[model samples]
Structure formats: C-alpha cells, structure tokens
Target: MVTAISGFEPTSLSLVAELIGTAVFAASGASAAVGKRLDLFGVVVIGTLCALGGGAVRDILIDAKPLVLTDWRYPLVAVLASLVVFRFHPALSRMRPTMLVLDAAGLALFTVVGTLKGLDYGFAVYAACIVGVLSGIGGGILRDVLVQEIPAVLREDFYAMAAVIGAIIVSVGARWESQIGHWTLMLIAIATIFVVRMVAIRYRWQAPKPNI
Candidate 1:
C-alpha cells in the first residue's frame, strides 16, 4: 500500500525485481550445474537454492515472511528457469559472456531489492547496506557451497565488493528519497552495481592477496 508520488509502489517494485533476480540467478545456477555435468535433479536443486536463498536470509533477518516460502510465484519462476536452462544448456553453455552479464544483472537487482526491503522494514542506512550485501551474495554462496566451489563473496574476484558498493548506493540514495523518487534511486543503484561488476570483470580485477 505504500505508493510514492510517481505512482510507484515500493512493494510491487520489489516483488518484480525479486522475481527477475530469482530467474536470473536460477539460470546461472542451472548453467553452472550443467557445466559440472550434474544430473537434472541436481540442476533443479542448485537453481532453486540460488534463486531463493538470498531472499530467505534477508526475510529471516528482518522478521518478515520469506517470499520463497510464502509466494508460489517465486519457486515456480525459479524452477521454470532451471528447466529451460537444462533443456537448452548446450546453447547456454556456449554463451559464457552472456551468463556473466546475467549474473551481474542479478546481483544488481538483488542488492537494490534487499536494501529497499531493509528500509521498508525500518532498518537504518548502514545496517540496511549490510543487509543488502547479504541479500545480494547469500544465494551465490549457497550455490557455490553446494557445488563444492568457493563462494564468490570469499573469492579473489570483486563480486562481493561490487555488491557492497551497490548496497551502499541504494542505502545512501534512499536518504534523499523525497528529492529523488525511490524508483529513480532504485534504477540508479541497479545500473551502478551492474556497471561496477561488469567493469571489474572486464578489467580482471582481483582482491589483494597476502604477500607471503
């Protein structure tokens, strides 16, 4: 019921973003499973876990209903995404760059959605930023753990850092919500996060390692 001046409904927007992010992440998970030569059931499991894990963690932290549990559409979308990937994995596997793009898009969408949800739940900016980062990376961590791979957040790649920056952008921009519409801020945060992540990928950015 929270409607903004631009006729933007925060809850509705969040729902849409969450579903899209879920699908994107699900596809990524399915694709990964396919690459690893997992069976169909394993592909579905990984996809579902990647799609819902982050939102579930965020909801639990905020004491809100987990969308993956309460909303049927979420799991359905995830499953459908997984099935589609499984069916056409040959083409998908060939498009590694495309998958990377989708992953970045998923991260951006989830980060913004998480940060906004935190604000909706009355969290302060900094705390909400942390929640946002958690929301962005939780699913990927679960996916990686299941596949016996190191979580992207803990890797030398710039994945978690990109999410952290995106979360901060959303949280800080939210402070000026009146001056700039929340929807506008949401779009800005998503774009910023996506760009940062893509740029990092292109540049082969690496987290600093020990000099030992």
Candidate 2:
C-alpha cells in the first residue's frame, strides 16, 4: 500500500529522492547526447531537459506553473549533473547500470510526486495515477526524441509499467493512510517501483509484443 503526504513536509528522504532523480536523469540525458555525438552544450541541454521536462509537463497538465521556470534549484541540480557527466564521461561510460538504477529511483519518486500533485489539484485518484506515469516518463521521452531514438518506455521492459504500478499504489494507498502511515506507504510504493524496474533490467524481461 502507498499514499501521498498532505501538508507536504519536506522529508529528508523525499528531498534526497528528488535530488537523486534529477541528477541521474540528467546523467542519462547526457549519455544520450554523447551517443548522438553531441557537444558539451548539447549534453547540458539534453541533461537539463531530461531532469526537468517531466515535471514541467506534469505541472502544465495540472494547470500549475512549470517548476523549472520558477525553481532555480531544479535546473541547478541538473546543471551540476551535466557538468559532472561532461567532465567524466569516459569514466561514466562504465557506470551505465548505476545510471539505470538511479533512473529507477527517480522514476519511483516522480511517480509518487506526480500522483500526489495531481490529487492536490483535485484530479481523481485514477487520473492522478495516469499523471504520475506521465511525470515519470515524460522527460525521458523528450530526451530520447530529441536524440532521435524511440522512447525506451515504449520499447523496453517494465520501465513505464513500474512507474504505473507505483502510481497506482500511491493512489490506492491513500484510502488506507490511517492504517498505514502515509510516509511508510509512499516508501513502500517507491521501493516496489524501483525493485520492479531493476528486476526487469537484470533479467532482460520485456513486455510481450505483437509478432507481426
């Protein structure tokens, strides 16, 4: 079970999750830029896009101002990550799995955040869950499309589904928040998403597709 925290006190764990998600998503985007033979500026731009694009889309959909435009910290985190990757790309190349793991964590966190945000804005639980999935994958889709590649969520394993499940947990768990603490429920949901994604990556699991 999972739930959203109301009156959102910025918990240390939640802050860390946000930072990790921003940094690793930035790293992933930077890596994509490298794959496309992009220059340093391109890497930074792509990284920033991946870090903040999802949240931006989520905000827009919910009729909120884009956080990236209002929050310096969001882009700051992304810039720092982009700089690190730009300077250490050669070494970072060997850390692909670490990046993916971090991305999984980010996905989980964003799913929770997105769903909660939607609920806060008066969306129904299921709609908020859908928003959560969008918030988890929107940035990656933007990054990949910019790089001229298919969005990984559309082509691969449990990437999108993992986030969807996490969002669903958050949506449903709100009903049981009194029985299970909201924070605890949120943690459980995040863990479920991260584990599901990691397992899919480790086992090379892919969603079944049409043979045609």
Candidate 3:
C-alpha cells in the first residue's frame, strides 16, 4: 500500500521546493526547444514533458498515480515556468551558467525525493536507487527526444552518476539513526552534485568513450 509521509504536510517548504524544481526543469526544456525554433505548442509540450516526465515514470514504476495528475499545482508550476522562459527569451538565452546550476539543483532534489518516496512505498533499496536515478534523468531524456538530440544523460557528463551518488547518500543516511541524518544527507548530496557538475563542466571531465 502507498503510504504518505506524515507530519510533512504539503506546506510551504514542500510546495516551494517542488515549484522551484519544476520551473527550472521546464525552463531548461523550453529553452532548448526555443533554441531550435520550435513552434509555441511544441515548446509548451517540451516544457511540460520535462517538468513531469520523470515523476510520471517514477509513479508508474512504483504502482502509484502520478502526483502531477493528482495535484493540480504541478502543471500550473510547469506552465508558469515555461511562460517565464518564453517571455524573457533574450535574457535567458545568455544565462547558460545559471541554467546549468538550476539543472544541478533540480537533479539533486529530485533524486532524494524519488528515493525517499520509493522507500515509503516499501520498495527494496535496489529498486529505490533505480527509481531515484530514473526520476533524475527522465525529464532530460524527454527534452532531448522533443529536440531530436541524443539525451544528455547518455553523454560524457556525470548526469546520472551525480544522481546515483545523491541517492546513495540518502539511502545510507536513512540506514543510520542519526537525528538530522536525513536532512544532512540531502544537503550533502545536493552540494556534492552541484560542485561535481560545476567542476566537470570547468575541466571538461567525461566518462571514457568506448574504444571500438
């Protein structure tokens, strides 16, 4: 049975976190589509897909209804985000550095939420890890598909690896009984992913390509 986390009502913190993540994800997708000169409808589609794709897939895999569908706020958050990107196209165009940082933050936050949700559903740790990684990369994959490019997750950057690292930290932290362990692990994971991503971008770090 699906059980909700108690005492963590969908208060301001949770709502704000979700909104921020959704907006960044949507902005990234819309920005990519706009760069390709896709139609307005196409841009919106990409934006919505990027915002909800990950959560949708995770929900299905976990045998639960997507939160995006159950809660109207998610779509609203996505649409609003897309509009912001669309309206400020020129300014956003030059914010590549800012966009990368936002993406990293979204990746870290989503990974932890996915892992925790999986555990709440009584899934095994291995399954939780898979769900976490999928939730982190699913949106980007959908974005690439809409733009007709190879998904960034499959590229040489540490996209999925960063998510996995974050998920592992959360999972391991939950195993220990330290009182603030969960939050500490989450902060650490987010920081690690952000720092690692920035450094990788700076140094052009990449996974080894096949020698075939």
Q: Could you say which candidate leads in lDDT?
A: 2
The reply for model 3, stretches above 4 Å from the true place, is 1-10, 177-180
Best by the TM-score measure:
2
lDDT of 3 by residue, 138-180 (tens): 9989899879899978986877787888787776666662565
| Per-residue lDDT value at 171 in model 1 | 87
For model 3, give the 10-residue run with minimal summed lDDT: 1-10
Q: Which regions of candidate 1 deviate over 4 angstroms?
A: 1-17
**Residue 25 in model 2: lDDT:** 91
Local distance difference test, per candidate?
Answer: 0.86, 0.88, 0.81
Cα-based lDDT at residue 181, candidate 3: 48
Error of 3 at 117 (Å): 0.8
Expressed as tens digits, the lDDT of each residue in 80-107 for candidate 2 is 9998998999999998777788888899
Q: What's the TM for model 3?
A: 0.91
Q: Candidate 2 — which residues are off by over 4 angstroms? A: 1-10
Pull out the clashing pairs in model 3. none
